[model samples]
Target chain A: MSTIARSPRRAAFFLSDRTGITVEMLGHSLLSQFENVPFDETTLPYLDTEEKAAAVVRKINERASADGLRPLVFSTFVNPQIRFVLDSANALHLDCFSIFIASMEAELGIRSSHAIGLSHRVGQPLDHGRRIEAIQFTLEHDDGLSQRNWQQADITLTGISRTGKTPTCLYLALQYGIYAANYPLIPEDFNRVELPAQFKKLRGKLFGFTIDPMRLHRIRSERKPDSEYASLKNCQYEVRQAETLMRREGIPYLDVTSKSIEELATAVLHQAKLERKIY
Target chain B: MSTIARSPRRAAFFLSDRTGITVEMLGHSLLSQFENVPFDETTLPYLDTEEKAAAVVRKINERASADGLRPLVFSTFVNPQIRFVLDSANALHLDCFSIFIASMEAELGIRSSHAIGLSHRVGQPLDHGRRIEAIQFTLEHDDGLSQRNWQQADITLTGISRTGKTPTCLYLALQYGIYAANYPLIPEDFNRVELPAQFKKLRGKLFGFTIDPMRLHRIRSERKPDSEYASLKNCQYEVRQAETLMRREGIPYLDVTSKSIEELATAVLHQAKLERKIY
Candidate 1:
């Protein structure tokens, strides 16, 4: 065997020319894929100048020297000056891992399920072209937009009692800054003939959140134990039919089963390709 | 104003022993604090061992040589060996700023918050204690922990329709691993003879979450327009009485007004001095 030894510790740097939090979150989750070796991370930010970037490399080099550390760095920013900073840094035993470096190779070589850029992936000009444009306009408006056109919401979520929707919508609003408006899909509206006209025309925006039949059954069972809605079979049927109708209409959705509101929102963003609006 | 020219660009590194995401968040917040010159940042990770730490320093030194990068390294980990590595790296850098170094004078002068290990300023005993201990057990056995003698929850959250208790409890469960069990404080419960006896005995474990009356009023106003329950006056009265009852019972509480769920949870943890269970 060659004399290449693998060290137990690996250092990673999530560097960015701007706010490095986004890159760090992505890197943290991606690194989570590896369960064995523990990951230690540090971030460097505002890497706008050659001198500042070089200083960052120096710190990395010194740390590596002390601990015999080899590090991976992931950086994203609009600036090109950061490259020189990493290039001139003590490259002896340091390894930089930038997504940009991978993106080129990924785009050229393999098939990627996910596309780059928030606008391209999320605001696809195909099926959701109109609503996406409308959303863009809504965001550009000055006065509080939600109060103006909430009834015209593309996607409306209705649920009896406490099926989480508002928090999820707020998360969507805050994260992607999407103009998300929530309508409580209540019991009265559940039996209504006309789905809101806006949602009818923009069915693509209409998504539903449902929990496991047993979990919902149990949840409602606690509130109104003897009610027919709390019965497992009835709960199961409502969920199944609702899901079937959504599927037949080609409306995408996710089961909010046993997931934290954050996890659910993250999954929704991932699946729905909702570019989380970074605040 | 002195003779030595001060460049507006300073080099900063937001370092962490483990996940750097929190550091990144802190860094962004800190940058927002500074109105003047923008600084640059670099990130590094996987620094649990001695060799890795040395390598990071060497890289820093090399970069310092090429550019006048006044490196500022903010890290949370404690390692005796880092001193030797940093000493060597300092030979190249004119100035350095490490939070650990700044904290050292205090450490040497004063007895540590803990007998051994880093001080409490790093938010030691990072756990929410027993409530979260129960939550972890429940999540690990999420299928049916309620079936067991899990009735004695530390604290219980109760609220009316859409008052944000389940999501908050789930957040506590996920973040602190607190076995937060919530029961709806329905109209019937509101009209009960007494508050739950479980809270009476375990008063320390009991806390309340209430939002501003106006917010509650607006939230209710949306769902059941023109209804007495949704009326601003009713919401205000109920909220006032709820606050009064909580105060009378000596339960600590928070106003979830215009705050994100994360902010609310953090405030609660801080108020409770709940040790963040660092995973």
Candidate 2:
């Protein structure tokens, strides 16, 4: 066995603005991308004040210089006052990273896609009356459940069975505290018009999800063993029909193939721009 | 809105060594302990060879020098040969972190009351079979039907309803590709002296999960309003009884109330000291 002992180095990160917990989580996920590196982490919240921002920068620069290290800053200082604070850090030649800076072009480039806007992604911003109405209709259509308890749902995921919908929905709810509710699209609804009547007037807020025909066919085949529902031909027809319906009706949708749970959820949220109800 | 062009600094972390993913996740979570700074991350697989270890260290040092930044390294290098390669990075003076270094003392510090030493931790000898058992069981339990397919199940989850058993089990199967089976622990099982006959004979490999009774009560109440199953009294009784059963049977278990899904899963794997099947 070989022994090597050295004092660990200190590389600091500073946040000049208060992006709140969202940026914190995003940063955390980003750091998880690196597991082989060791450095201490520190956060300075509520950097809206120039005094606080400057203080953070001063501390970071001091730490980096004293330890012969560099600091990485993840910030979103949209306010001009905050700009002065970061400008101070820049004078010190500190390294910084803002995801917005990297992703702005990518975000703008997405405009050309048949993209669904945010409000529709989060159920179309229904009025209280409409929300209650939609809930009642959902209850009536499905297991005859009551609406008194549905508001507690952080998010409701609605989709067809075997679409990997339930697992994904539950993942959102459990992992992110998004009370997602999923509704199955049954065989009878294949050609139905007006989108269950409840979803008609609320079309603006509706989000649709679809999967590859071949994959769905394989998934169904695993469940029933030998059934027409699992037939690739039927799956292709259904997928095409579903896509056509979504396009014609202007329902926003996502293709979940080849996406992990985190990526799919993040993409959906990014598309919906859902104001996270819980941290 | 004022426009302030502030670049957020990005930090990459790589955790290489035994069960590197756990260290990666923990390091990420620990960032939460610091509520101010934000990070961007990249995790590398375990360095099983000296060549890969050297290449990784070289690449990281190069990135650090090129970016004019020194990144943090959090790893658990087990193979002495790999450690030899990693040590060479000291020439660049990068901030290196090895969870193994912390874990060695932390493992020893685990309270005797806690069932420690049952699983392979950072510095423990590899127990590849237990991990394979967990993984195999998880795979067989895929998509929540493995309970019905018990014979094919390698690891089974038996718990009262809404204890988060299903989703957790599915995460193990889906994320880690482990086949995990889940069985409901009903009223009858609560009264039994022996585990399900299947598990009774396999007590050494069995695991029990318990959560805060109040949380369990709240969750169940949501599902079956005003029903006895959702009654706080029932939840308390079941949890107490389950604890007693586990203790009597010498079955290892975890209290999952305060833990996140990832934490709970890792804690269980850590407690069971199961070897990871993933390469």
Top candidate, metric TM-score: 2
Cα displacement (angstroms), candidate 2, residue A227, comes to 3.0
Per-candidate DockQ versus the true complex? 0.02, 0.03
RMSD in Å for model 2 = 17.5
Considering only the true interface residues, what is the Cα RMSD of candidate 2 after superposition?
A: 16.1
Candidate 2 residue-wise lDDT, A87-183, digit = tens = 6662222212221222322322322121212112222111112232322233233321334444444444444545544444434443334545544
Q: All candidates' TM-scores? A: 0.37, 0.48
Model 2 lDDT, residue B207, Cα: 65
Best by DockQ: 2
